[model samples]
Target: MAPMNIFDNTETAFQLKSDSELERAYFLFKMISMEPLVKIGSAVTKFALNVNLPVEGLIRSTVFDHFCGGVNERDCMGTVDRLHDVGVSSVLDFSVEGKEEDAQFDATANKVIELTLLSKNMEAMPFCVFKPTGFGRFKIYQKITENQALTENDKEEWKSIESRYDKVSKTAHASGIRLLIDAEESWMQDAADELCEKMMEKYNVDRPIVFNTLQCYRWDRLEYLKKLHQRAKAKGYKLGFKIVRGAYMEKENDRAIEKGYKSPICESKKATDDNFNEVLAYILNNLDDIELFIGTHNEYSSYLAMELMEQKGISKSDDRVWFGQLFGMSDHISFNLGAIGYNVAKYIPFGPVKDVMPYLIRRAEENTSVAGQTSRELTLLKKEKQRRKL
Candidate 1:
């Protein structure tokens, strides 16, 4: 069995954080643990930003600095280098959201391509990620997912979206960098999944340069993965997947109820955990054909992956396996894993302060909602504080 409490080493976990920074993290998690404060603060922040209130500085100093790398690729290098010093790599995530225009989509695509080029020689950053909606409108994906008839303009729009994806994927392949395509709402995910597979067929010829996400909250994901694996095998291409526990459970359930359809989400959190572990085991078992990026902060999942890898005699530094966590969260897992020679990366989110508020707010709300996430963070922070005697 893998060692228990391997993640409890506060010294290694917070080795990079200064006394002040540790206190700030503790305070931030404390604030996030209060569900009511997060709701009220999210609303007020939105209002303040909309009315041109001078809250950007305040936001940047506290949550933004802690959670985000910076506003742009160049701005993020310091954080990137810092993490790399401790053996953890980074995935630069441009976290801006809610765009409905062609120009915005093109710009996002261009930024991703530019970032991929920038990372070509940088060992600190080996990966790039972008959301499906970042390259096109949500409605387009939903329409295609539902198999509804598209207007002529929709076809043109979708073609543009595909062009954007192709440009980014080609650049990533050429630069020898891996690209992660994030999953979104279930209504729109089918279209994204199909497009991602197409990219994998084109770019993942030698290895997995293009990876799609599997949100295991949905019970059907394991079956979907099995079918996709069969297709990839027949088509003669490698496959890569980033497995996540999903992010939109409440929205998924509420939408299902309103539409009078069965929810695609698993019925309980335990079921979701089971589904995630099952899929993880499946991909690990098929590492010959599929490379995996385990994107979770759950300690048990991390430990399980370690145990499974041990049982299979996989090297701790196997290039085909990676562990990932978001920046500013789960330092215990990220840093300790890196310290022990596991391949790990942090998803470093960055964007303009005002534009990335939605992402930041969602992070706060998610921390509040996920059971034990905030408390665990607080516990580690406290332990680190005591160790530092600060």
Candidate 2:
């Protein structure tokens, strides 16, 4: 293989100095590099106007434009076409979050179903992702997970949750679009897992129509993956698993410490990386029985997966194995993987601007948390700026 620097290939192409687009990226990096500033700004804004303000313009100019398809399904069509032009596809993930009402849940479910239906006609969209919390109350999920007896009202709410999922699953199945249930915080995860398993049994019979995300940073998740695989095998159905390093390590650890319980997170980053690679190997080894989605921003992990495919004699274009990155974080990985003819798709998120504030805040915090992320972005912008000067 020829020597390749993916970042150089990706970042150097767009001139940073003369490019207005590149300057906007510099501004975003500066904003997200300080967590205290982001938090204080968010608090002030929320206090001043009892609503999530429009942060989309800042996001759109930098992260969203680079990573997301667009603000809505209609807006994302151009993104879909562009990715398809390069042999990649898109997965629609509605970015709205933090809903507590049954009516809101029902509406969110309906929107997902509509998106799935729309995806049926669009060749570029192969998968649709949803969060159970988007349609179910968190406290209700907590109660069920804790084995609390449900009151009549709670039972009615649970029924609505079931119906909402059913609507999404049925639409996705009918439309031939896959559904990926995103993992949530550890406290609320048991219920989400139960719900996902139920959905899998119903919709994943003939094929793996629904996937449950497994965060490998959780110490128990590798074993969970194995157990899930065993269940799928015994049931004589295919299993779909989306493996990720995780999104909420800090929160999970802090809560565990506060409650005086054993932390569910891996003890170290190495441990998480090991578990992630092991799960990747296991899925690839059992390729016929499991469909795998490798979701990460780590370049080596992505490369290792490709290497594993070569070792196992699996084609790089295998439909069962996919490479996914969040909508706004890793264009270098996504675009280069797409360039190499791999089965790649971005997790495209969209909603009205205010409803997506939580998602945006997390994105900012994550970039800041990952050491060197902002600096790396700054370096790339600076390098590209200097290159333009040449």
Query: lDDT of each prediction vs. the true structure?
Result: 0.96, 0.80
> Which model scores highest in TM-score?
1
Q: How many backbone overlaps does candidate 2 show? A: 1
How does residue 150 of candidate 1 score in lDDT? 97
Candidate 1 Cα misplacement greater than 4 A, ranges: none
Q: Which pairs clash (backbone N, Cα, C closer than 3 Å) in model 1? A: none
In the range 1-390, model 2's lDDT, one tens digit per residue, is 322476465442332124776777677778788889878866764454354455557645665565455667888877678667766688887888899877888888988988888888887888888997998988888898878999999999988898888889888878888898899888888888988888888888888888999999998987888898898889877888899988898999999999999999999988998989998899999988889999988877887888888888888788899999876566667777777778988888877655665776677777878777678777767777666668
Which 10 consecutive residues of model 2 have the lowest summed lDDT?
9-18
Model 1 shows how many backbone clashes? Answer: 0
- Per-residue lDDT tens digits for candidate 1, residues 1-390, read 788888999999999999999999999999999999999999999999999999999999999999999888888998899899999999999998999999999999999998999899998888899999999999999999999999999999999999999999999999999999999999999999999999999999899999999999999999999999999999999999999999988899999999999999999999999999999999999999999999999999999999999999999999999999999999999999999999999999999999999999999999998999999999999998987886
lDDT of 2 at 351: 74
Candidate 2 deviant stretches above 4 angstroms: 1-4, 11-18, 48-71
TM-scores across all candidates? 0.99, 0.92
lDDT, residue 369, model 2:
86
Clashing pairs in 2: 67-327
Worst 10 residues of 1 by lDDT: 381-390
